[model samples]
Target: MGTYKQQSHVVWQCNYHIVLCPKYRFRVLTGLVKDLVEHDIKMLCQWKDCEVEELSVQPDHIHLLVSIPPKVSISELMGLLKGKLAIKLFKSYPQLKQKPYWGNHFWSRGYFVNTIGLNEDMIRRYVLHQEEEDKKEETNGKHFTLFD
Candidate 1:
């Protein structure tokens, strides 16, 4: 049996995903989204102790596959990523503050965080495929307005 205890600063693969405003349902496009996701992921990866392997941004939410050191809590990781990304987003696109965004949130509250170890490949595929599944849901035409 392996111990669950965390070793200090040990690199642990982590995934964090969150949503944007519901207004993006029909208003946003996936083209520039790669730029947005890339910018943030690049910054996070450039930070002292974070490495982002895969990242994609859909109209509604963002999917990030990353590895972080043990010293950071999931909460801390989210805070740093969100705070930095939000500001960078607004600066990159000045219209972000004036238009109909996912409810003035810039970013949805709460996030989906998963710890990766043995099943890293499986989890990475799952996270990366979120956009494809989301696009496949046209039958229902249902959307999540608020960050759940």
Candidate 2:
């Protein structure tokens, strides 16, 4: 269940369902790479004072249901998360620059975001079960497995 947050003159429960994919829809998210991505996402959310109610990282994309404060715009938050994650990933794995990938780009230029209104419970359930539902066959010899 989501809780209301009280500000100076507002009480809110602003939650959103956000989905993002890798650049060119590449299947590079697996094994250690997946772990790092998930960790970085949690760290970033915490830094932004946002709360992640549920998260699922697939082989090519990610699903997150998060509670954000009224003061922050969705685009600003998304940009920060995506930008910082790319920087960290690139730094941690310089070999990714060799082939099959290029430049400073990581995530795709666009994302899918929806506000959690009356369907908050339904959205939460969907996000929670996304891992099992989004499971894909191993690609590039990298097995797809769920990581906390």
Candidate 3:
């Protein structure tokens, strides 16, 4: 067998973002997200014991930059964020208990998460700029993904 690669305490810094469907965009999901998750959003930053570096909620999607420990995987972290919020929100409000809430789940199945390698500023700008670009695209009547 080949020698095993040594592992270090790798700080997994990542930027996560995702959007909702256009129909529901009319519902002002962003506003609702802020109202429904204002306090909880802070809590979510620490989901899975991960440290939240920044949090930005846009009109359609959310921008979450966090550094996760090696003990937890990115998918697991996302699950925790989406799961915890959905459970609490669904329990609190009956309106979101409706169908296809974020594609049969609390959050949209596919999300954009970028792994930080170098020049963190570039990555940060990309994450933040995505909100503006997406809004412009939506305003221009550009089509959304199939989920939309």
Best by lDDT: 2
Query: If the candidates were sorted by their TM-score against the true structure, best first, what order would they fall in?
Result: 2, 1, 3
- lDDT for predicted candidate 1 compared with the true structure: 0.61
Candidate 3's TM-score reads: 0.56
**C-alpha lDDT score of every prediction, in listed order:** 0.61, 0.87, 0.60
TM-score of each: 0.57, 0.77, 0.56
Give me the displacement of residue 6 in model 3, in angstroms: 16
On the 0 to 100 scale, the lDDT of residue 4 in model 2 is 88
Q: Best-fitting candidate, measured by TM-score? A: 2
lDDT digits (tens) for residues 29-141 of candidate 3 = 56665667656766775646666666666656667666665677777776666778777766776566566444335555566777644567987999999999999998998
Candidate 2 lDDT by residue in tens digits, 2-90: 57888889999999999999998898889999999898889889888889889899999999999998888899899998999898889
Can you list the residue pairs that collide in candidate 3? none
Off by over 4 Å in 1: 1-29, 102-104, 119-148
Clashes of 2: 0
